[model samples]
Target: MNETVNQPTYKRQRFLLSFVHQINGSVSVTDLQKLVFLHMMSEDSNYYEFIPCKYGPYSFQLKEDLDILQRGGFVTLDYVQGSERIKATGDFPTGYFFRIPTERGKALMRRAYREYPYYSINSEITDRFFQGEELEQFNRGKQTYAQTEQVLFTIGYEGKSIEAFINTLIQNNVRLLCDVRKNPISRKFGFSKGKLKHIAQTVGIRYVHIPDLGIDSDKRRSLATLDDYKHLFEDYEKTLPSKKRFLDEILMLLQQNTRIALMCFELESNMCHRHVIRDYLVRTNQVRSVDI
Candidate 1:
């Protein structure tokens, strides 16, 4: 270990390090994702949340942390098998971090596929491990997120993980997430505009930032009750009629997309300005609205 390893650590980073060390000092990227996914699925004590990716369940946050450890000299990377040609430029081959699994990693992969069938929905290799009921269950879970209906949804990301928030969109079959914040940003991981957009589209949900529909940040600073929100929204509602052009755009998108979601930052629709927008669409365009 280096002096950098002596520095105080983030809990999640420590968890990742411990996980990698438990299996050995290293693991291939895919198997590590699967292992972490299985651990999270167990006992409901999740240390990280994952989104489905090309191979299966994946966590970008975990990948970033691994890079942090490698840079701190707490870990090393080396290419395995076919990945040898894809070396990192002027560095210790970060490509090595994405290698084929070791024998231990392979065992973990087999275990994860058997235990967490849902996470294996998009698996590149786990398909060979299943047949009969296991295969049917996996196929069923794969289609769980596929819904097609013309329902309008309103959702907020407060007090939820990115995984939870995205899961809502996926579960409701929301095709587009219309962000209704004046400032499309958040301190939360995967909730800021760029990251949120990337995460949404990664899971087949489109994202759009409709900042024109946002309440001013200065206005949202001190709302303490439903009455306060009501008072603010009464005035806020007056401005919507004048912003009809943007509302028209939203209506157009909803019509074209089949299913869309309005998103802001509060957990409850009653506490957020998005409810006002949802109501406006409901009353004027006859858009079906569901607070999620």
Candidate 2:
């Protein structure tokens, strides 16, 4: 027997599948619900309505839509057993995990992401729900995406120990360390290219040295004041267009790695050529910069 489904209901099912697919193929049921709730709160012309529930918000229709998708083979759900610790405490903590969509489901999601790219990114959706303290804490934790378009970060190690520097990278969940120094040598014991690479590798962080992105020692050593830095950056900016190969190499790296830290020696980003590199990336490549 063939059963008929309403257009609205069918659209919602596709939307749900697309949403799950957009968030890296799988998400915990709670996160999926929260993301949907947040999306509805953000967009006035959203598909779902919700009433308040014990866990912040509730949408029975959303659950029904998911079930419909599951029955039609658009999505699959698996029950993850509760942890032993929770069982010992006499409280079970089972989780519902959803798998990636089927081939047919993926086709629909690809179309959905194209139609709704703003809602496709996990960071974009999660950023809306985190508040002051929570936001700070979340930023301090590992970030989820590395190849996030138009996003970059810069860091200075002038006043930091290697341990502190690595900790900062880990805190921010930086996966790649881009050394924008012409000479990867430092007076600091642990900061030389070889040593730094070893340390980064020990902690599962990738290290890359891009000399073309750095200023020559003569220009760097000549800087004595803010005006000098300003002039140097101005001159450095002029050379960026000619360095297309290096710039493309960096863009490729960013595409491959999620979070990258542009490392240099100045304590403040304002005093270093790395900032100029960051600005160049942001201006030329249309990326955003976060100084961490």
Instruction: Judging by lDDT against the true structure, name the best candidate.
Output: 1
Give per-residue CA lDDT, model 2, range 164-187, as digits (tens).
677677656677899989999998
RMSD of 2: 19.4
Give the runs in model 2 whose Cα sits over 4 Å from its true position.
1-150
lDDT of 1 by residue, 29-112 (tens): 766777677667764656788766546678877777777877776566667873311112122212113222344445776676
User: Can you tell me which runs of candidate 1 are displaced by over 4 Å?
Assistant: 1-8, 82-111, 122-137
- For residue 52, give model 1's deviation from the true position in Å: 2.7
Q: Could you tell me every candidate's TM-score relative to the true structure?
A: 0.83, 0.49
Whole-model alpha-carbon lDDT for candidate 2: 0.63
Pick out the ten consecutive residues of candidate 2 with the lowest summed lDDT: 83-92
TM-score of 1: 0.83
